[model samples]
Target: MQQKIAVLGPGSWGTALAKSLVENGHDVRLWSHKEEPVQEINNKHTNEAYLKGIELPKELKATSNMAEAVADVDAVLFVVPTKAIRSVAKQLVAVLETKPVIIHASKGFEQETHKRISEILEEEIPSEKRQNVVVLSGPSHAEELAVRDITTVTAACEDLEQAKYVQDLFMNDYFRIYTNTDVLGVETGAALKNIIALGSGAIHGLGFGDNAKAALMTRGLAEISRLGVAMGADPLTFIGLSGVGDLIVTCTSVHSRNWRAGDLLGKGHNLDEILENMGMIVEGVSTTKAAYELAQDLNVDMPITETIYNVIYKGQDVKEAVRQLMLREGRSE
Candidate 1:
């Protein structure tokens, strides 16, 4: 059965997902806040600014008008950045008429409030205007998925039926979707892994070998699990696709913006310069600040996260930060 889906935000990930839905035989309306991308996506069947050289599905439509994109859609998938989710949700509720299932692929906590994307949606989108809120996450990347490279992700909602519906909507020959009930774990793993990816990239930038990167990732997972479990997430979900899987891919892959940004930092570039150079959102930078605060508030022991926070925020030398981490009091693993 075909469904009318609206994908908000036309960045690399959003455009790729919209194209995938169009190929899956569904009516997809991709919304962009900027008119340039909208015109490019609709007129040229390409989003050259973001996807660069990748052609989009001809059937996919792009709009700058929020209402126009979401009108009569069976589901509205928010693919905007974490900071924009609340503002976008406010705009959505103002225009949304149908009680479509709300899904979000964006990962990160609200900077000021530390709320999840689903929580922001729940508070902004009136209950009468939507069904269960679902979070779609995993190790997948936009660049790879845009080119039809095999990818898999998790669709998590407390409501099993809603999760299965999203699974069916996105599953294809190259893209596979799994259902999980641990929304807390899925969201936590999705947001926190970017920080680790940044650290991994920094390790590479500093000319460290595989052993160093491996240690950072292994201990990074421990920190992520500690914070997540303290917040009431299922411990098992940390090892699943959104957890260990996302950590490996984002930390190791060159395609990750967070990793790339961290790599620049590791090579001795300043945070502002690295972000300006990337010309895209480096989620881990903001995530590091937010996670640091959250860990402090929750009294969770996250040495790696604390170290990265010092490098990015406290102006500590990256090499010195790594040294401090190595010198920490050792405990049995």
Candidate 2:
């Protein structure tokens, strides 16, 4: 059953998802602020700016106007970064018609406010207007998905029926979707894995072998689980595709911007420098601050995240951060 779908935010991941939906036979429309990317997708059937070399379907349409995109859409999938969700939602105030079930593909919690994307949507989109809100997350790399890889994920929402509906939209031969009731765990798992990916990149930058990177990834999952469970996230969800599965993919895959950003930062580059050099939005940088603060507030021991925060924010040395973690009071795992 193909439904009219509007994917808000035309970043790489957003565009990739648009491609997937179009291929899956949905009436897909993409809206981006930038004209070049949209024009590229519209005129040439390729998103050269983002997913270079991969040609999108001619059926997929691109527009700069939100009014045109959201008109009678079945679902409004939010794919923008955490920092931009509120502002974008505010902009959608005039254009949104029925608040078609929001399926947020971006991962990460908001800074200071400590709100998830679902929370932000609930507050922004009115109750009467809202459709089912679902979060689709897992170890999915947009680059891989654009090429039609077998990517599996969890569609989670407070409402079970809502999760199943969203699963119906994105699930296909190449793209598989599972349903989970723990939206907090699914969202947290998606958000938190990037932090570990950063740690992996830091080790990679320092010329460390697989063993060091492996340690960071595993222990990183532990820290994420501790805080996520404390916050009412399902403990088992952390072990699923959105948890350990995502950690493995993001940490090792060069396609992940989070790990790549950390790689540059680990090699003596600052946050500003890394962003400028990478020329992309690395969600981990902001989420690192949020998670660091979250750990402090919740009294959760997230040593790996704390170390990355120090390296990125407090101008601490990466080697020193590693040494401190190594020398920490040892206990049984």
Candidate 3:
């Protein structure tokens, strides 16, 4: 069963996902906003700017024309950055036909808007097909995914059948998929975990050990669950693939752009220097600001998120932030 799929954004995650679907025998039309990435994919079957070492499937057609990208597609996979989803979704309105089932692979809440990626999509996509929205999230990283490393993830949607459809379309011997109904929980977990991963990386960069990292990861989850539950999500969803699962992988992996950014910050490099050098989107960087503001607005207690916010935006010393975190009143877990 060959399905025509449209994948927007040609960054690491977007390219990896397009490759994954293409290898599974789907006809994938991948759209890149930049002409260079599109040319590399169409002519050489590679995304030089992002997934450099991996070869993309020849069947994965690359297009700069949005209409050509979405034409006759059975499904659309959105892999753009959180901050960029709104504008991309707005543009998609012009190219789309009968609305395709939309799957979002992004993992952060919009900072100024405080809206989830799916939320932004809902506004741009028709209301009649809102339930068609599905979120694919877990511990999947683009680099390993490109090399065919075994990966597992959860697909969440309000419609069980829709979730299963996505699970069937992408799952393979190397990739296992699970389905759940808690879309909000899954998306929130994926977005919020970036905040804590940065904290763990900061501790790691400051010459900390496993104990410190563990404490941050554990307590960090408590905050994520608190916010999720408050926002009408199923509480148990936080324990699932998108929550604790993604949290662990992002916090521990050296490949996480968010954590690596924090590591440089903890080691004394400024945010401007780190961003200029990385030349990529660190979802956790802006997400920290967004989550901190969200916690305050919702009256949620997220100490770790707050302190990191101070270090990054308030220009507080990283060591002082660490000391302040330790000096806070200790309570029983």
Candidate 4:
């Protein structure tokens, strides 16, 4: 069945999802904050800044007007950054005439509140105007998905029927969707894995071979699972797509902004320089701070996350941090 879907955000992920929806035969309206990208997507069918070489579906229309985008849409996919979720949700409240299946593809926490993206959405968007929220996350990257690479992700919602509806809406030959009821586990895994990806990039940037990278990834997963369990998430979810799956892809892929930023840091560039150079949100940077705070509050011993926090926020040298990490007291795995 064909439906009208509005993709809020014209970033790489948003554009790729819009393209997928268009391929699935839905009417897609991609919303961009800026006029230039909106005009480019509308007139030229491409988003050069995010997806440089890929061409968007010409049928994927874009607009800057919030009212027009949400008007009568069957579903609204929030693809914006975590920091922007509250503001966007407020905007949606103003224009949304009917309750739509609200789905978010963003993967990060609110730095100020240390709340997950779904939590922020629920807090900002009134329950009367929005249905139960769904989170779409996993190992998929925008660049790979835009080119129709085989990708799998999970759709998590408290409501199984709603999750299955989303599963049917997005499932295709190139993109596979799995449904889960563990929203807490899925969202926590999605947010925390970016920190591990940053660590992975740093390991590679420091000229460490696969052995070191593998160690970091393994240890990183352990700590992530620890934190997730403390926060009421399923322990097994850490081994699943949103957990180890996302950690592997984001840490290893050049398409990951977090890993790229960490790579730059490993190569001796500062965080400010990295952010300026990339011109895109390296979610792990902010997420590192939030996760660090959460770990401290929860009394979770996340040494890797602590090291990343110090390296990024405390002006600690990457090499020195790694040395300190290696010198820590041994523990049984």
Candidate 2's C-alpha lDDT? 0.88
Name the runs in model 2 displaced over 4 angstroms: none
Give candidate 4 misplaced runs (Cα > 4 Å): none
Could you say which candidate leads in lDDT?
A: 1
Candidate 3 regions off by >4 Å?
A: 128-131
- What TM-score against the true fold does each predicted structure earn? 0.99, 0.97, 0.98, 0.99
lDDT scores of the candidates, listed in order: 0.93, 0.88, 0.89, 0.93
lDDT tens string, model 4, 5-88? 999999999999999999999999999889999999989988999999998888889999999998999999999999999999
lDDT of 1 by residue, 1-333 (tens): 999999999988898888889999999999989999989888999998779899888899999999999999999999999999999999998888889999999999999799988999999998899999999999988999999999999999999999999999999999999999999999999999999999999999999989999999999999999999999999999999999999999999999999998888889988888888786788898999999999999999999999999999999999999998999987999
* Cα lDDT of model 3 by residue, 85-108, tens digit: 988888888767756889999999
**Count of residue pairs whose backbone atoms collide, per candidate:** 0, 0, 0, 0
The residue ranges of model 1 lying beyond 4 angstroms of the native Cα positions read: none
Angstrom error at residue 288, model 2: 0.9
Clashing pairs in 2: none
Who is ahead in lDDT, 1 or 3?
1
Q: Tell me the deviation in Å of residue 259 in model 3.
A: 1.0
In candidate 4, the residue pairs with backbone N, CA or C atoms under 3 Å apart (3 or more residues apart, or in different chains) clash, namely none
